[model samples]
Target: MGGLATAMLGCPGMPELPEVETIRRSLLSRLEGRRLVAVAASGSPLRQPIQEAAWQACVGARLEDLTRRGKYLIGHLGRHAAVFHLGMSGRLLVQPASSPAPAHTHLTLGFSDGLELRLVDPRRFGVAVVMPAEEVSLYPPLARLGVDPLEGDVEAALASLAGTRAPIRNALLDQSVVAGLGNIYANEALARAGIRPTTPAGRLSPARRARLARATRDTLADALAAGGTTLADGGFVDGDGNGGYFAVALRVYGREGQPCQECGAAIRRAVMAGRSAFYCPRCQR
Candidate 1:
């Protein structure tokens, strides 16, 4: 209905391990004691609309734990848990409850501290599912995702990719293959490993796979240190309005037409799965 609402419908920037980690950290600090006093839905289908009364039922519930499963954030509040997927454009904002609700704010959790945790999704693709806390891990979305790169093992990741014929890049983006890597880090990792994005998954040499694994971990760690990426027109912000770490340290993603930071070669962009993949031909191959 509004620009923010339209924005929510379009895909938000792909989030990698670092960006999700940043969100998890921010929510842990800001929403732990907060209560979910109300919920509201706007411009969303009735079947999945953010139910106001359903959310209100959890009023006064304390956030017992906060965890990240792949790219999703799970908030355990006693017997109930709130699960959120940031989608492509979903954002979670913490602000004073008195602050006017933004137009695309589909879900609001009012806290006793006079603050509110808002789910502002311009595309309306983000979802907030409520379920029993104890069963959260069994939820289909959470259950299907593979190891989170931030907490997963490199050997395991390589083993998972050992026999695949899919492009190494595609394998990296497959949630069931290895959770939490999006296009950005996938490109960066391939570049760092000196592996081509078009390389066959099972074709990677052991040394190269090890390099890729190290690159994946290192790139994510660097992004975590810097915050996260902030793409053009993609205004992802922390509670304080700071840009993400990966955004600041981005080397190849969104840098098409620019020189590669490592090899001085031109960075290139290609479409894969209808999404842009940025890489440096010289460095990546």
Candidate 2:
């Protein structure tokens, strides 16, 4: 096969942490130890200005390591590293060398193995920035985020929340509290933990906090294994162009007015922190 998937897409939407993780896993399988043969930018500039020289520096460099911090992908290419952020609706697709580049493909990283990885984003929000290998953590875009929810220190995360009266739902969205959480999984985890979204973060009993942490970790892990949630809009998908099965297992997200799968109560939606939160009142509280 030439590419990562068999489909062509324009723009979908922002992929949350789990979706981003799934994409990273896909890249790792294809990119590890591969030498980058070329780099090209074909579309308009993304949310940030494209540095032509930075993109060019990737040429002839080997992908030594690949990792994810928050929602960003860090590719160690010899002396330089490139960080990728899939803004709303961005797709990082892998294809064969013979395939024609898709429309709105902002960047392509050609590898010695004949696999071409394309970044397509009609919205032009996706970007790849090249930086010094040793200074990736200090890079401006990644410096302020919280720890990875799956592998990060959960006790430290909970300790910080004990002093905040912020709504538990809204607090989970804060990257500084626990990196890479988005609206959908936040709703799902809270429901799984049987905690109300509107509950104050600091008011969480120690036991509830433990359950929330467990639920958050398990929810994200399960979603990643299931290839991340692909909503009805088809916003999030893996490199293989497949939608996720995790959506079928969702407890409360996007299920407003529908009966709760666990308690049979009517699911409800609330506006918190300017985002919609779906929950079942009886099950959550």
Candidate 3:
């Protein structure tokens, strides 16, 4: 593999918390208070099949709010809400109704306005479901999710993994330990905290754990501000279908063999659980 390709070896294709949150914020203005005038499904199956009856219930309902739980987007509509998870390579796009529907458009929701919200996923791993708004927290995916690293006490959340022998990078990827974290940011956060990705979660000292937690939040905040990372292959976009630019700010996630900004040593990459973990050899210990 070439330099950049080799460096991006194990970065996940799935959208993480920052990407999802960006989508939520972008869609909120366009979708909130707008009545759903039409709804359609292509009968294609995703991670789970698109529930037609569930979506049909959303017709004529007004979107009151849009929120994020982990990597999922929940749009509140009166008594019901639509929940969406952009599994690998899925995108929720907002475009003028006059525009031709993009290929692989599995679901289309037309609002009272002239715009349409479409779910396009060529890989068919995304999810779209609707249920009572009051029961959203009880939904299986949201119910099982751990604390939001940005919203909750991430240090406490990391405390739960203190007993696990797995590498700290692997532990961060656990949705039950810190919801919304993906492989890329996990590695970047470790790099920021000056810790090796392969360090055992259980072996981290209390001070190190606190530092990791802070670094994780800071990494996410920076990514969120940059509109999230869009890699060459992943093609992540916001609600308006604009791409993310955080890739330029990445420190070590995909810069294998590049000089560490901190210490002038070449960055390194290691394969862990089928994913690549990038770090600065001289700076991280």
Candidate 4:
């Protein structure tokens, strides 16, 4: 493999907006309009406990729509909606009802068409919950999410960070600041914006903030088009179990010590807020 490909290889990370949006789109066609015939749980708890009764309420309800907010997938089912979050190592797979499920499968929703949607999370950090369809927007998790870079005015959102003293990269990861941006895209966006990840959020000028905002949108758009980033550990995949191709196109997320594709300077890595931030030393600054 080439250097770029080699640099993309790294351990799994959480699914950000792009990965979650990709999963939502991949599952929409197969799941929407299909009646949920059954619901099952593995009795293992995730980030939140799997309430079989709440999920059971979704049974027999036709899936009217599947939408995304931040990193959550919402399935509209009559009076109820099933919400899903693919935590650090979670996956949502669509397979035949008769197909054997992978281990750590927390929740399973059987459709009327012999297909089944499964939530498999090895680390148990994902969530599967059901509540009134009307209440989805009011749900704490969804309600607290800030501006969605793709769906909302990201420039305005970034502007709100003008006074934040946290590192620009960390501020971007704040869901209340820019919903759904994780470390991977945060680092990539900083590189694209010609800003260092360690730069203080409050220190960014208006022009730089605008540049970073645009870079964030562009980075996410590219990742969504590529399906989503699937790390070397194969952490993220679409509902069809296919890995995304964006990892190879990553500019800085996991390329520590690698040559900067733009400046030939070695990429640098910094530990910030317990997560790794990658940046081009010469290009970003």
Model 4, which residues run further than 4 Å from truth? 1-11
Clashing residue pairs for model 2 = 2-95, 2-96, 3-94, 3-95, 3-96, 4-94, 4-95, 13-89
Displacement of residue 135 (Cα, Å) in model 1 is 1.5
How many collisions between residues are there in candidate 1?
14
The TM-score that candidate 3 achieves is: 0.95
- Model 3 lDDT, full chain set: 0.87
Q: Which candidate, 1 or 3, would have the higher lDDT against the true structure?
A: 3
Q: Candidate 2 — which residues are off by over 4 angstroms?
A: 1-12
Where does the lowest 10-residue lDDT sum fall in candidate 2? Answer: 2-11
For model 1 the local lDDT of residue 45 reads: 41
Each prediction's TM-score versus the true structure: 0.90, 0.92, 0.95, 0.95
TM-score of 4: 0.95
lDDT of 3 by residue, 1-285 (tens): 233453345635568888999898998878788999888899989888888888887888888999888888888888997899998779999898999999999999999878899999987878899988888889988999998988999888877776789999999988988899988899899999999999999888889989999999999999999999998776689999887888888899878899999898999989888778899988899
Better of 1 and 4 by TM-score: 4
Query: How many clashes (backbone N, Cα, C below 3 Å) per candidate?
Result: 14, 8, 0, 0
